[model samples]
Target: MQPENVRQASYRGVEDPQRLYLAMLQDGEHDAREWLSTQLRRTASMADDLPDDPAQLESWAANHAAQVATDHTRYLTRRHQGAPRHYFANRAHALWFLQQVAPTKVVDGAWLHGVLRHWRDFRFHGLIRTFLEELGDGDPRCNHVLIYQRLLSRLGCDQGLPLDPSRYLQGVVQLALGRHAEHFLPEVIGYNLGYEQPPLHLLITTHELAELGIDAHYFQLHVTIDNAACGHARRALQSLRLLMPGQCAKAFYDRVRQGYRLNDLGIDTPSMIVSFDLEDELLAALQRKRPYGQFMHSDRCRLQGRTINQWLADAEAMPGFLRALEAQQWVRRGEAPSHSRFWTLIDGPQAAMFGVFTAYEKQLLHDWIVGDTAAEDCRRVRPGQWERDLALEQDAPVAQGEVCVDRMIERMWGNRHATPNGLRATRDFIHATGLTRAGPN
Candidate 1:
C-alpha cells in the first residue's frame, strides 16, 4: 500500500488515535483490550504481506535519501529566492510562537524513548545504537529536549514542561503518536526520517529569530544535528538498513513511508505563521482558563453590570466585559495601568486570581491590552548555565578514616540505584534509631 493510504487507513476508524490512546490509559485498558496497543498491533500487521527482498530494500532506501535531498535543496532555493516574510513578525511574535510550540519541541524524542527501551529490553543492539545516538547516549545535558528547554529558559519563555497534549498542533500530534505507538518500527523510523530531514522551516526560523534578537540555538542545534548529509537523517537511513536487512526489507519500507507521510498531516511553519491571529489567540487563552475561574467572585464584585465571575465565563463575552470595565473607568489600555483592577487580578501577586495563567499567557494578555510599546527587559542568563546545569556528577566523597554506620548509610543512600521509596525507608530507620549527629543516644 502507498504510505499516504496507510496513514489514512490508520486513522479511519478512530476519532483521534492520540486522544483515544490517552483515554484508554485513563480508563485502565490493558494488554489486548487496550486501545493503544491494539492500534499498534493492527498497524504492525499491515506490513505482513510485503515480501522481503534485501536488494530491493537497499535500492528503496537510497532512492528515498536522493529524493529527500533533492526536495530539501529545491525548498531551500525557493525560500531564498522568494525571500518570504518572516514566520514571526517580530521578537514578541517569535516568543509567543515559540511558547505555543514549546511543548512539542521540548518532548522531541519522548516517543522514541519507548522504542529505545523496547529495543534494550529485547536486546536489539542495532536499534539500541541508532536510538542511543539520538539520545546523545543518555546524557541529560546533551539531550535534545534539555537543549530546547535551555533555549526556552534563556529567552525567558517559561511555558514549563510536559504541556497539555490538547495544546499541540495536529502535525505535532501525528509525529508524537507515531513514535509512541511502538507497533510499527518501520513507520517510527520513517517519522524519524521525515522529522530529521533538513527542512526549509528550520533554516528560515533560525535566520528570522536571530534577526529578532532572540537566541535561536534550539533551531541552530537541530540544523546541525539533523543535517541530511551527516547527521540524524543519514543515521536514520543507516538504521533502516541495519535493522531491516534481508527478508524484513519490504515490510519495513512500507511502514516507513506511512510514518513519513504522517509528517504532512499537521500544521507547517508557514501555515501556522499565516494562521496566527494574536487577538483571537488571546481570547482563546482566556477562554481556556475561564471555566476554572468562573465562580471565583460573587455578584457583589460586579464592576459595571457583570461580576468578575461573569466576565470570566465566556470568551465571546470577554471583549464586552473589558469594554464595561473601560466604561466604568476601571482599566486604561495602551499603558501599564498599575491601578487597573482587572490587570491587578490577572497579574498581581496578592490578587485572588494569582497563578491562574502562565507567564506566556500573561504576556499575551499584557501585550494585547497594553500594546507592545512597553519597554520590557529580556531575561538574560550566563552562557555557562547550560553546561553547569547538565554537568555530570562523576565522583563520590571518599572516606579516609574508619567509616561510621551513619556515614555508610549516607553513602549507600547516595547510590544511583537507590530508589526514592528505599531512601525514605532508610531515613525513617535512621530517625527511629534516635541517633543524633554527635553520637547515638
Candidate 2:
C-alpha cells in the first residue's frame, strides 16, 4: 500500500512552464527551438549590427564598453536624484521574490564552468580566468552560490526553494542549454556576454533594496563583479578574441547574438513582480494538490460535513474548508496559530504530508489563513552583518593544537602538487582524529 501521504497527494502532477520548456528542448522539439532561435536573432538585431571586419568588430566592442560605463553612471545619478518606487513592499515581500528565483540564482556561471571544462585542452587564458573566478578560488564557502545561500539564511529563508525545474524561468534554462551544447561555443560565449554585462536592472535592484532596509549584497556583488568596464563582461569579450582570432568572425558573432537573445526568452524580474498575487498563488497551490486528493479515503478525515477528499476536490470549497477548520477550533483566523492541526499537517517535521510543499507554498498558506496584513518586522542588518553572523556560527571553542591540525588538513587537501598517497594520508589522519569523539554513527 502507498504511504498515507503518497496516497493522499503528490507534487509530481504540478505544471511548471519552465519544466515544459526544458522538456521541449531535450526532446528536440524543432518548432520550439526554431522559435527560440528566431526570437534570439530578433533581440540581438536591436543592438549594434556585427561588423564583417574582425578589427572593426573589436573596435565595436570597445565602443560598446565605453557606452556601458557612461550608461551606468547616468542611471546611478538618476536613482540618487529621486528614489524609485520600492520594487518590493517590505522585507517579507522581497524575501518571497528572492526565494522564487533562488533555484536559478548564480547558476549561469556553473553552466559556463561545464563549457570551459570541454575546452581545457586548448588552454584559453581568458576563459581559464573567468572559470577560476566562477569556482571562487576553489573555496566552496566563497562560491557565488554559497554567497547567495548566506544571504538567504540572513533573511531566515535558509530552508531553500524547491528544486522543481518548473520553478526556473525559460531564459534560465537557455543558459543550461548553451553550456550543455558543447559544440556551440559562440552561443555559450554570447550567453556569457549578455549575462555578465551589468544591466540597469541590477543597479536599480541593489539601490531599491538597500533603501527598503533589506540586505542587497547579492545584487551589489553582481553589479561590481559583472561590470562591463573591467569585469566579467570584459573577460567574456577577451575570451572570444583569444579563442577564435579572426577565424570565421562573422559566423561566430552571429551565433553569439543568438545566445545573447536567449536572456529575453523567459520570465524576467518585472514579470515576477507584476504576477505576484497572493490569493491567486494560494488558490493555484491548492488546485495543484486537488487531483491527488480527489480520490483519497474520506473515512480517515472529515470536515465541513464532507470528507477531506471532498473538500480538496472542489476548487471553490476552500473558504468553506477554512470555516469548518475554524468551527472545530483547529485554526485561528487572524493570528499565527502555531497550535493549529491543519498548519501542522501542512508544515510540521512529522507532518503526514511532509516534503510535499515548498517553503513558499507553506508561507502563502500561513499568510492566507492568518489574514496577515501586518508589516514586515524583520530588522535590517548592516552591509556585512550576514558575513559576521556566518563567522560567529562557524567559530567554535577548540584546542590550539586541534585548530592547527585542522588547518594543516585543509592545506593538504588544497595543494595541487600533493601526491595521491599524501592526500590519502591527510584524509586518514582526520578520520583517526575523529575517533576521539564519543558518538555512535
The candidate that wins on TM-score is 1
What TM-scores do the predictions have? 0.60, 0.59
Candidate 2: clashing pairs of residues: none
Which residues of candidate 1, in runs, are more than 4 Å off? 1-85, 89-96, 99-103, 111-130, 149-183, 208-215, 247-252, 288-316, 325-357, 370-390, 395-441
Instruction: Report the C-alpha lDDT of model 1 over 304-371, residue by residue, as the tens digit.
Output: 76688878876678768657777886777767746566778867789767887776666666666566
Give the per-residue lDDT digits (tens) of candidate 2, residues 1-441. Answer: 111112111123324545644554344322233444444545554443345454565566666556656866777777579744435544445667777777566353543533433323443545545544543433333345556766777666777644445456443344444335465567677666667766555666676677667777777777777765677877777777766647666777778766665555445565555556666666666777678778855566887568888888788887676678889877766766466777887677788878677665676767666664544344554654555443212223234365554443333221210233323333333343441222498
TM-score of 2: 0.59
lDDT of 2: 0.56
lDDT assessment of candidate 1? 0.53
